[model samples]
Target chain A: MNNHDRFVTDTAADIAAIARTEGWLVPPAPIGRIALRPWQQAVFWGLRIYIGIMLVIMGLGFFHVAGG
Target chain B: MSAETDILAPAEADRITYTEELEARLHDRLRIQRLRSAPRGLANRLALGLALIGPGLLVMLGDNDAGGVITYAQTGATYGFSLFIPLMIPLGFIAYLVQEMTIRLGAVTRRGHAEMIWKRYGAFWGAFSLIDLVVANILTLMTEFIGIRVASAIFHIPYLVTIPLAFAFIVGILVFLKYYTWERISLFVAAFNLVFVPLALFSHPDWGAIGRTFTGSGWALPGGLFSAGFLILVSANIGTTIAPWQLFFQQSCVVDKGLLPRDIAASRRDLMLGVIGMVAVAISIIVISGQYLHDLPNAASLGDHSVLAGIGSRLGHGAMVIFALGLLEAGMIASIVITASTAWAIGEALDVPRSVNISPRRSLYFYAPAILGTAIAAGVLMLPHVPVGFLNLTVQVIATVFMPAAMLFLLMLLNDRELLGEHVNSPIRNVLSVGVMVMLIVCNGLYGIATVFPHAL
Candidate 1:
C-alpha cells in the first residue's frame, strides 16, 4: 500500500490502543480550562480577523488596488 | 501475509517507530476526545489547530526582518509604491509555496535541513551551503544590529549602549526559554511590527493612487533614472520577502516543536496569516515612506536615518515614538530568530549538541554561534562609515541570487519519495516554485545590470 494508506492504518491502530488504555484519557475539566481560556479565545479571534483582512487585501491586490 | 508483515521488517518497522515517536511528541497537545461513548466534538479540532500554529507564523515573520523592513522602506521612498504593489501578491504566494515544502520535509524526515544536506548532498556540497549560510547570516545579523542602532539614534541613544544591551537581551531570551516559550514570546515581539499599519494612516495618501498601482497601467511609467532607482528598491523588496535562512530556521523549528502530519494543515493556516501580516507591515513601510520622504528634495541625501525619521515625523510624535519602539522590538525579534538559526544549523550539521532545552553550559555549541553572531554584528555596527548602505544593497542582491540554491535543495528533498512519499508536493506546487525561481533570476539579472552600470539608463 501507499504512504497515505499506511498512515491511515497506523493511526487507526494507535487510536484504538489509546482508547483501550483508560489511563491516557483526559478528564473534561482540564479540557474545558485548556480550550476555553480568555487568552486562548483572544488568539482565535485575532487570527480570524487577521486572515479576513488578508483575504480582502488579496482581493484588492488582484484588482491592482493595493498601494505598493 | 507477506514476510514484510513481520515486526522486524526494516522499512515498515522504522516507519512505525517514526510515527510513534511523532505521536507521543504531539500527545501533550493533540487532545483527542473519546468519541466512542464520550462524544465526537469540535473542541478536539480546536486544540489540534492551536498546536500546529507556530512553525509557519515563525517562518513568515522571520522572513520580514530588519533587512526586509529597510528594503520595503527604500522601495517606497524611491518608487512611490506603483509596480511593487502587485509583486507582493506573487511574492507572498512564493513564500508560502517554498515554506510549505519545508514543513512536509521536516515532519516526515525528523531531520533538520543541515543534517539532510550533510547526509544526502555529500560533505562538499553541504559545506558549500553551510559556509554560504553562515557568511550571509553574519552579514544579515549585522544589518539587524544596524537597524537597532539607527532606531535608537532616533531617540538619542548611543550605539555603544544599545548594541551590547540588545545582544544581552537576545541571548537572555534564547538561553532561558525553551522551544515553546521562545516561539510564543517571539510571536509577541513580531506582533509589534503591525504598529506600522495604523502609522500608515498618517501618510494621507490618495487611495486612488494606491488602487491604480495594482492595475498595471500605473506600472507602465517611463523607465529612466527614477525607474532604475526604483528597481533597486524592488530588488530589496524581493530580498526581504524571500531569504535563505528562513527555510533552515522553519524546518528546524518544526522538528524542534515536534510537529506531525496532523499538525500540517494548521501550520499552513498559521503561515498564511503570517505572510499576510508580513506583507501588510511591509506595504505600510512603503506607504509611510512614499507619502512623506519621497517628496523631500534631499531625500536621497537625507540618508537612512533621515528617511526613518521622516516617516516617524509624519505620524506625529506619538506615532514616530511608537514606530521607533516597533523598530527596536522588530529588530530584537529578528536578532533572536536569526542567531538561533545560525546556532541550530551549526549544531545539527556538525552533529554537535543543540536545542534551547539544554542548559547553556550543556548546549554551548548551540549557543556559541548565536552569541558569536550577535557580538560580531554589534561590533560591526559600532564602527565608523561601515558601508551600511552598500552592504545592505549587496545583502539583497546576494540573497536573491542564493535563494534558488537553497530552494533547490528544499524542493529536491521534498520530492524525494524516500523522504516525503505521499507528502511530496503536488505538480501545481512544482510549477509555481519553478516560476518563482525564474522570476528571481530575471529580477536579480536586471538588478545587477542597474547596479553595475547605474548611468547606462
Candidate 2:
C-alpha cells in the first residue's frame, strides 16, 4: 500500500482503539447528557432571558438607527 | 436493520473518521514523529516549537481583528495612555487563561469545540451555540470588510475596488490552500499586525508618562470612569479580547493540527506568546493613537479612516500609510481566521467532511457555508446606502449577548472530569475562571445596557 493509504488504515485502527476508550470523533449519540443542577439551570435560563431582552432592546435601537 | 449491518456500522464510522483526520492532519502527524526521532538540542527544540505553534498564535492574533484595532485606537484616542494601557496586561493573562483551556481540551479530546458541545450537550444547546456562532461570525465578518473597505481609502483605493479585491483574496486563500499552508500564509499576514509597533515609535510618545501608567498613575481616567463613553470603550476592549469565535477557532485548529496530549505544554507556551503578541500590538496601537489622534477633534468617535487621516496630518503621510496598512492587514487576517472558524464549526456540527485539507472537488459543501457567509457579508457592504455602519453596531450587540454563554460552555467542558480525566480544571482554576467569567458577564451586561440605552449610562 502507499504511505498515505497505510496512514489511513493505521489511523483507523488507532481511532477504533480510542473510540472504545475515550469516545468517537463524531459520536452518534452523546456519551452522556449533562443534567443541570438547580442553580446551573437557573443560570442557563437567566442567560436565555438576558439574551432575549437584549435582542429586543438592541433590535429596537437598530431600527431607530436605520430609520434615523 | 439487520444485526450484521448494525455490527458493521461502527467500524465503517471509524474508518470514515480515520480518513478525514488523516487527510487533514497527515503532515502534522509526520512532523510530530520526526520531532520525536530528531536529536534533542536547543535549536531543534526551537524548530519543533515553531512547528507546534499554529492554533494559539492564530487565535490570539486573530483576536486583534479589524474591529479590535479600531477599539484599541478608540481607547488610546479617548483615554490616552491612561488606565487602558495598563489594563491590557491583566487582560492578556485573562485571554491566556481562557484560551489555555481550549488547548488542553483539543489536545486531549482530539475533537473540535463545536463537536464537543454538540455531543455532550445534545442538539438543543448545540444548535443554540451553532446559530450564535454562525450569526456572530457573519455579522463580525461584515465589520472586517468594512474596515478593509475604509482602511483601503488611505491608499487612494475606493471601497468599490477594495471590497471585491479583499473578498476575492480572503476566499482564495481559504478555499485553495490546505490547513498547513493556509496557517503559514495566515501567520505571515498576521505578522503585519505588529506594524502598529513602528507607528507607535514614530509618534514619539512620552516615555515617562507611558511608564507611569504601569507605576500606579495609569488609573487617572482622562474621561470619568462612569461616563458612557468610557464604559463603551472598556466593553469593546473586553469583548475584543476574549471572544466566542476564538474558542471554536483555536480548539478546532489544535484538533486539525493533530496535537497530542504531549504537546499541551508547548501549546500553552504558544498561547502565552500569542497573548503577549495580541496585547503588545493592542498597546502599540493605543500608544500611536494616544500620541497623535487623542487631541484631534471628537477623537473618541473617530472611525478608522478618520484615525488614519489624523495620523497622516500629525505623524506625516508616510506613517499614516503604514498605519493604514496595519488596519487593512487587521481586517484581512481577521477575515481569514474568523471565516475558517465558521467553516470548522459548521463542518463539525453537521458531521460532514470538514477540514482545511478537504478538497473542494470532493466535499465542496463543507467549504460553501463560510464562503457563502463571506459573500453575503461583502454583498451587504456593497449595496447602496445599506446602513452598513448600523450593522457594525449589531455586531457588537450580538457579540456581547453571546460571550457569557460562550464562557460558561468553555468552563463546563474544562470541568468535565469524565472527558478530561486528571486534566480537569483544578479547584483554584475553577475559582479564578468563575471569577473572570462573572466579571465578563457583568461587563457584557453593561455593554448591552450602554449600547442599547445611550441615555441610561
Candidate 3:
C-alpha cells in the first residue's frame, strides 16, 4: 500500500482504540462527499432569507444617511 | 478478518478517524514522546510552558488590535480615567471565561469552531457564521491597516512604503513558518504591546486620582448612565474585547497547537496571563492619554493621531514615538491573527487542510483568504480620502451585530453532549455565559439605537 493510505489506516486504528478505552463510539463515516443533512439544509435556507432581509435594512440605512 | 479487510476497514471504520481528531491524537502522542525524551529539569518545564503559550497569548494580544487600542485612546481622551479604565478589569474576566471555553472545546472535539458548527448544526447556521466572520474579518483588517498608516504617517513614512512592507511582513510569517515557529514569532511581537505600560509610567499621571476613580463613583457618567455617547463607547469596548473572529481563531489555534486534554490547565494559565497583559496594556493607554488630553477642548472630537500628537506635546517626541510604535505593533500582530482566523475558518468549513503545519501547496485554501484579505485592506488604505471614520464605526457595528450569533453557536456547541461528551460547560459556566451574553446584547442594542439617532445623547 502507498504511504498515505497506510498512514491513514494506522491513525484510524489508533483513534478507534482510544475511543473504545474512553467508552465512546466512533461515528460512521459519511458516504461520498460531505453533504448537509436534511435539518441543516433547512437551517441554511432560513439563514439565507434572514441575511437577505438584513442586507435590505442595511442598504436602506446607507441611503438614508447619504440622503440626510 | 483478512489482511485486506483489516487494511481497508480502518479507513471505512468511523468518521472520527477520518476527521482531524486522528491527526490531533497523533500530534499529542508525538508531543508526549518529546516530553519523555527530554532531560527532566527547569529547561524541560520551560519547554512545556513555551509550547502551551501560543493560542491564548495570540488571542488576548490580538484582542488589543489597532481598533481596540484606538478605542481605548479615544475613551481616555473623551472621558479621562473614569469608568472605562476600571471597566477593562472585569472585561478581562469575561474574555477569559469565553476564551477558556474555546480551548476546552478545541481540545475535546479536536476541531475548529466553524467545523463543529457546520458538522453538528448544519449548513444554514454554518454559512451564517462564515459570512459574518469573513465580512467582519476583512473590515477589521481595514482598521488594522488604518492603524499602520496612521502610525507610519507619524514618523513621516508614506503609505507607499508602509502598505507593501506590512503586507509582505504579515504574509511572509504566515506562509513560511509552521505552527511552532509561527507562534513563537507571534509571541515575540505580542511582547511589544507592553510598550504602552512603560510609556504610561513616563507620563507620570496622578496615581492617587487614578486609584480614587477606581473605587469612587467615577463609574457614573456625567451625562447620566444611559447617555447615547456612553452606551456607544461601552459597545465599542465590548465589541473590541469579545469578537466573532476570536471565537473561531482561538479554537483553531488550540487545535493547531495540538493541545490535548491534559494540557488544558496550562492553556488556562496561558489565557489568564494573556487577559492580565491585555487589560494592563489597555489601561496604560487610557491612563497616558487621559492624563495628557483629558482637559483639551473637543478631546472627544480628536482622532487617534491627534491623541498621539497631544501626547507628544505633553511628554515630548520620544513618548509619542513610543505610543506610535505600540500602535504599529498592535496592528501588525492583530493583522496576522485576523488573517489566520479567516483562513482557518474557511478552510475548516470546506474540510480542507487548515493547520499551519501543512505545506503551502497543500494548504492553499488555508492561506488564501488571509493573504487576499491583507492585500485588499492594504490596497484600500492607498486610496485617497477613504472614509476611515465611517469605516471604523461600521466595523464595530458589524462586529456587535454578529457577536450574539457567534456566542450562541459557541454556547450551544459547548453544551452539546454528543460532541463535547464529559467536557460540556458546567452550571456556573452556563450562568456566567448567559450573563455575559445578556450584557453584550443590551450594549449592542443601545449602541445600535444611539448610532441611528445621534441626537439621542
Judged by DockQ, which candidate is best?
A: 2
Superposed by TM-score, candidate 3 places the C-alpha of residue B353 at a distance from the truth, in angstroms, of 1.4
Position A2, candidate 3: lDDT: 20
Candidates' RMSD to native: 13.9, 6.1, 6.6
Worst 10 residues of 1 chain A by lDDT: A27-36
Candidate 1 per-residue lDDT, tens place, B155-264, comes to 88888899889898888888876665677788888788788788787657777788778886456544553344555456557778777888888888877776657557
- Candidate order by TM-score, decreasing, is 2, 3, 1
Let me know the TM-score candidate 3 reaches against the reference structure.
Answer: 0.83
Model 1 CAPRI quality: incorrect
Please provide, for model 2 over B263-373, each residue's C-alpha lDDT reduced to its tens digit, 9 standing for 90 to 100.
Answer: 899899889988999999999998888877777765555666677778888888899888888889998988998989998999888878888876777567778999999
- lDDT against the true structure, per candidate, is 0.66, 0.78, 0.76
Off by over 4 Å in 2: A1-30, A57-68, B1-21, B384-394, B447-457
Q: Show where candidate 1 strays beyond 4 Å.
A: A1-68, B1-48, B225-228, B297-303, B454-457
Best by TM-score: 2
State the weakest 10-residue window (summed lDDT) of model 1 chain B: B28-37
Give one digit per residue, the lDDT tens place, for model 3 in B401-440: 6776677778877887777779999999999998987787
| Ten-residue region with minimum lDDT total, candidate 3 chain B | B1-10
